[model samples]
Target chain A: MSSTREIDALIDMMAKLPGLGPRSARRAVLHLIRKRALLLTPLADLMQTVAVTARECLNCGNVGTSDICDICTSEKRANGELCVVEDVADLWAMERSGVFKGRYHVLGGTLSALDAIGPQELRIPRLIDRVSTENITEVILALNATIDGQTTAHYIADQLDGQVTLTSLAQGVPIGGELDYLDDGTITAAMRARKSL
Target chain B: MSSTREIDALIDMMAKLPGLGPRSARRAVLHLIRKRALLLTPLADLMQTVAVTARECLNCGNVGTSDICDICTSEKRANGELCVVEDVADLWAMERSGVFKGRYHVLGGTLSALDAIGPQELRIPRLIDRVSTENITEVILALNATIDGQTTAHYIADQLDGQVTLTSLAQGVPIGGELDYLDDGTITAAMRARKSL
Candidate 1:
């Protein structure tokens, strides 16, 4: 009975996860009980480890296990190209294709005037600084093809207008399509056919 | 140029995420740069905090910010019914419904003979022990309808036969459909009409 309280509490918390409900949480908990070592134990261990070591890359804003992410420390990718996105999910989507050979900048979201979001609230200044300090030659505005995304892109283009080459993914990204929804082939095609903004 | 190398390394790592590709990662990185403070800075902070604090409930296998998950420690939920599931995702799905006032047991996965998984490899023993020690009156098997899921259910049922009431969610879970994919209403319906094995 005492442990049952604990179990109920666990189920309640689990129900709050993005996709689960009380029923499925109940089923899932039972399943985990039946596969403790292979799934439960390892999952628990991984969760604990990730809880303690997960972090965002200090220099580039990517999630990782270190202060300065692995990308920010590598010596093989200094190609003067910087790609942009709106969320970590989008960043993960891009990484799955394995075609881009540059660094990343996660925007977290689009500029929403209704939400009162502005450039100062974003990483616009840091981008400008990185453009100069990182000696970035080409800045690809690979944001989603939404109105806000395009607006943000135009704003950035204006800021670094004369300092560096500015380009963006061409054609494949549909109108209002978030980068996370596009397939690898489409993303690759878009990158290859990037147009100067 | 040096930072480009770092960026490339980061993109490479991003590509390894579940849904991203190189092209998208590049684009995402660029976006993050333009929205550094509004999005990137806060995201990084959150990631760092979550990375350091997320762990799993040792007793019921749910992920949380403590050694003994919040659910496990809470005293208000011991309803004598134990619902089981296959994964943390499923557990979360159940919790989202706001119903089911009992505990949970996460099995991690179904028993797969092809994968050489056995009862010992799962939390089966622990589950049986909990049934007795916790005064569990009803043990609900909410496993997926997959072949392996059914097999695991049968195996667990055999172990706990006549020890307590054993039932399963009635019908709403589609054949081979993961609980993660089911909507909350369907999960609730299934739970409300759960049938004895």
Candidate 2:
């Protein structure tokens, strides 16, 4: 081993993270060791705190430090609109735009029949309950443009057919996107959704 | 914030690592949270332990969880052959090869004139002390092939002129390298050091 047992173990765990490999993990571990007081200790303390306190909100399935997330409990976010997403990451991307003033419903994953995943496998049941009881006016299906995502969105739209208004994000050439580099499906969608000048 | 304060802080700290950015940091933190019991808690505990115990070897500059590293304390490694490297990471790489069963001397960094760093800025003085006292017969300059590395090696060779035999790593094609991809400098060095086939 290039390092001690404890250090090696730490590097191994870091390597298992999403973007880091063995070499980068070793560099990161060395950096953390050099800046022990500044980075390593505080990161360790923060990880421990998050581990003990972080949980998924019961209402919207969003991750937070309590049973109900801040967005779910805040009155300003009770704008009668609930945006449905495939994961917390999608919900976070939506929140980063700062254009949405309503709460979110995290589905955790889409309904995948090949994987034996159904509505109950995800948080779809809880989403249905929230739409019926929360006095929601509209449900936005801001899912990815994947087959599974569209299938899940269609299923949710069917379930809430007469309960409230159903909508989805518009598909078009993204801002700063070039038509030459776009895929055929995207180009076709943009052509069909063309608007007046 | 998409998540709680603690989670966001953790993500921010993770982003400061060498290979991770904000998006990847968020993904890593979310992974850590999902596997809190199996990964997060243990990693946090290990970081804490390493932060408290890790230190630089007094004799050499190798990092370990002690005042003097295991290599410095091992009697069988006293083979009168000292390998000098530029950093603790280099020392670890040397050890990983499982060759060179002697000892090591880490210089912390090379002497850089532009940075106003001299022999005293590195561990050159300590290396000289070890050559006189450690009964070393050969000193291998395992420095890098960079300009500063060569300059430091030449300086060290001059410092220990007649005391011990001096040598350096060979410059040529790497083990799995191809001729088409080899640089002109490396090809010239390989030609100069051509072996009798």
Candidate 3:
């Protein structure tokens, strides 16, 4: 607030970010101003570039710079399997692990009756189309374990009943999880689905 | 990383900001991409403008769009009282509170022995000159409560001992702070400086 209107406006916009509040926004603005050449200028340039070029992948609903995403177009990716996630962020998370070599189907969001979001609101139709046209043999539901997420997974499974082999992510103790710290549902799931050691 | 190069780069730069980790930065970048028209474009434009216009006030060391800040040029503010802080952020914090109606002197940073930073590294010399030239009657040290902050305050106090009245912000329990969560030093200070009920 002591700075000019432009600086204050920058702080206000930065504060609206997911994890950044007013306090951290101020710190970030100060840091950006101090490291203008190394951070601010480049950040501004990239933001502008992304603002102009970024678009949703028409085939999978994933965000990218082209009409079709890299994963959808890459011939190296496993074509028989498709990983379905509720959001583009989840798809990115799976990619970061470098485990799943197959392409992804971004649902855009989970089904929510309260919010009036159904199969039509998301990319369910597109996902079904990709499965048949892209020769997908298996559909892996990588949705979160939330109630709405499970509801969405079930709905998708019903829609694709006999068309493909469907599976959801395992629900159990996380890696490096402490038994005492885990919730009751997690502990029960972990115990019920105990694997052979 | 599944996103485009520019988006991934933006997320990387955002992760470097204070209080934002890689996960949150990814979320923020996605949100910006989704709301490009409403948030991203304006933010980029404003950042570019601030990058070019923001500068240190010649007299006060405050970050502003002009050589001399608005506060420094304002005759309405109390001229006899000068508040000194370690950074422009602190000056902005004071301004947000809207408590002190006086000009400020930003020290840039504290006197850090480990970093070999002394009075010359900060705006201590400028402060001394301003005290005499500006006819300052009182100098309030609004530096942080850290060890280095106290050391810098002592150094400044010594320099202006006889010339002007010197004072520093009080240290103790903060407003709305619970006694159970307060540290030993804070409790001791509060008890020593206890006031009549």
Top candidate when judged by lDDT against the true structure: 2
- Candidate 2, true inter-chain contacts retained: 0.77
The per-residue C-alpha lDDT of model 1 at residue B168 equals: 92
Question: Comparing to the true complex, what docking class would candidate 1 get?
Answer: incorrect
Question: Each candidate's interface RMSD, rounded to one decimal?
Answer: 10.4, 0.9, 0.9
Q: What is the DockQ of candidate 3?
A: 0.83
Q: Which candidate number maximizes DockQ?
A: 3
Candidate 2 Cα errors over 4 Å, as ranges: none
DockQ, all candidates in order: 0.07, 0.76, 0.83
Candidate 2 C-alpha lDDT tens digits along A1-197: 87578888888989999899988998899899999999999999999999899999998988889999999999999999999999888988999999999999999999999999999999999998999899899999999999999999999999999999999999999999998999999999999999999
Q: Which ranking of candidates, highest TM-score first?
A: 3, 2, 1
Q: Report the Cα lDDT for candidate 3.
A: 0.92
> On TM-score, who's better, 1 or 2?
2
Candidate 2, residues B1-197, lDDT tens digits: the string is 77789999999999999999999999998889889999999999999988998888899988888899899999999999999999877887898888999999999899998999999999999999999999999999999999999999999999999999999999999999999999999999999999998
Best by TM-score: 3
- A1-197: candidate 3 lDDT, tens digit per residue: 55788998999999998898999999999999999989999999989999999999988888999998988889998569999999999999899899998999999999999999989999999888888888889999999999999999999999999999998888898899888899999999888998997
Q: What RMSD value applies to candidate 3?
A: 1.2
For candidate 2, the per-residue lDDT at A154 reads: 95
Where does model 1 exceed 4 Å of error?
A1-197, B1-3, B173-197
lDDT of each: 0.69, 0.93, 0.92
